[model samples]
Target: MATYVNPGSAQAGAHGTIYREVSPEQLAVEQQLVDNVVASFDACQDPRLQELMTSLVKHLHAFIREVRLTEEEWGTAIDFLTRAGHITDEVRQEFILLSDTLGASMQTINVNNQAYQGATEATVFGPFFVEDSPAIELGDDLAFGAPGEPCWVEGTVTDTDGTPLAGALIEVWEADEDGLYDVQYEAGKRAGRAHLFSAPDGGYRFWGLTPTPYPIPDDGPVGKMLDAVGR
Candidate 1:
């Protein structure tokens, strides 16, 4: 194992770990490597692809250099990604969990969707959001008999101009008080989730489980990462 130490620091013995300060020559070499990698994509035909690849490589290299990343740590990251892939399935997406836990998902959303005056901000598109969710009429109970305290959620959909937007699609889903989503149970089980359209007055309301806090799936690699980082 290798570790980075500040300049002028001294260590006793190397017990399966080597600590050292970065040399100026080594720093130049690292920059050269990054430059060469970035230049290799110069011939890419698509400007957007080339730009994305170059930025990704530059940032990744910068991160590695900033942390003085060790070979062991790199191997651990590879293993973590492998485990994430293994745990992903029809209903489970470890990669999304990884992104969500890292705040990357929310950051991406924020970057793409600019904030307006007092409007709702976009949130993470979690893996549990099912397509074609059960459709319900306004004022109907979206819980569908799911066990939880009855709570009414109502709002008016409007545009930035303060005009009501009729027929706007409204989708809502959340875990029950037990901190379990419908997808966590056996297949074909749907609860605490529904989609409805706003009425002519741009008003919609439905009965759903009261909002509750729930933990992300922590039995997988992403969970291990959070635990490892003391998050």
Candidate 2:
């Protein structure tokens, strides 16, 4: 039997019990499986893709082995993923909900967005953002007659050095006072969302609804999972 050295334990280094109790035969078997999976990526033409695949395989295998995952648990995971895929459509994305709930979306945002002087910090773009939204001029109402108290919104687009960025596109969306985005309605209404460009002086303005708190869509499989975990 091979001694599994729990990572991050006090026995993690050279002087640990792992050096004494390790079974080379068992370790070779596990390591060879990882190596074989990694080698399958050798013919990949893209070096970056190969690297990512290899690393993913290695880490995924390690996690499975470390957790001693059971077949039943694996099957459950597959079922969850299948349900997530089935519920995803143009408007509803269960996978994005899963990622957001698990904080993976935020972690990815943090990794990709580096802090630059005087620049806006990147945030989750969210799944509700749609393409080809109606374009409006400055001071136009973004509410599009959607229900809620009218709110005036304005901002300036500028470079890191505070120089104005003329004609910069600004897109904004929000839920109405009822705490629901345009996509949540059954009628497929469009409201509380629009895009506009900055003026030559980098100034822009529009009318929108006041922000309100809303719950994430919880009728899907991800919501069930969260509920199962008592989140």
Candidate 3:
């Protein structure tokens, strides 16, 4: 038999107080959070945010129902999320990587930035982009002080009419020769890095050490989840 206690009562013993099971009111609070999110969207002026938040709530509620999740599983999930927050920092985004591996990032980008039919297809902007990188002149090498196989990356930004879009912003970032981005290195060096601007004719070029594929970071709950999934 289960015993009920006041909302704020404390339980004693090794097993601790089991507290009252989730009440109807408690479940209503959870559902209300989802409802509020949807209702708030109507007040949102930004179309993008409205669309995003609306979809987010819909899928989130769907997931909860699909799993028929238990209280223990929910508590474990909260713990995992807390740990993920603790592990995040200026150079690391464990949550973003989790989204990437789950295809959420790709889905968001694809949904928001539909292709223009003939334009280069956009892809996921992985968690390695660094803002305000030291700008370099045309044809300058971005490898900086790191060592790796030399490779040239050249492209042109152009308008739909096949004419180059000169002076377009062309920011480039990639992994080092060892398949690691500068943020991944603790030595405080910017290797296999670069920033270049498009020319008057939309042509842009820069040199950097060739990048190699590397495994994603595997030191958090997301990593554990991936391992469990045999990814």
Best by lDDT: 1
Query: For model 1, what is the alpha-carbon lDDT of residue 135?
Result: 98
Indicate the TM-score of model 3: 0.74
**TM-score for each of the candidates:** 0.87, 0.86, 0.74
Ordering by lDDT: 1, 2, 3
Name the candidate, 1 or 2, with the larger lDDT value: 1
lDDT of 2 by residue, 25-91 (tens): 8667878998899999999999999999998998888766655568999999999999999988887
The candidate with the higher TM-score, 2 or 3, is: 2
Candidate 1 residues 1-231, lDDT tens each?
234455687454355444457776887798899999999999999999999999999889876876678999999999999999998877778899888887899999999999988788888878788888999999999897778889988889998787999999998988988888888886678899999999998999998988888898888999888998999
Indicate the TM-score of model 1.
0.87
Look at candidate 2 and tell me the lDDT of residue 212.
84
* Candidate number with the higher TM-score (1 or 3): 1
Residue-by-residue lDDT tens digits, candidate 3, 1-43? 2233345663542346444444557656766887887887898
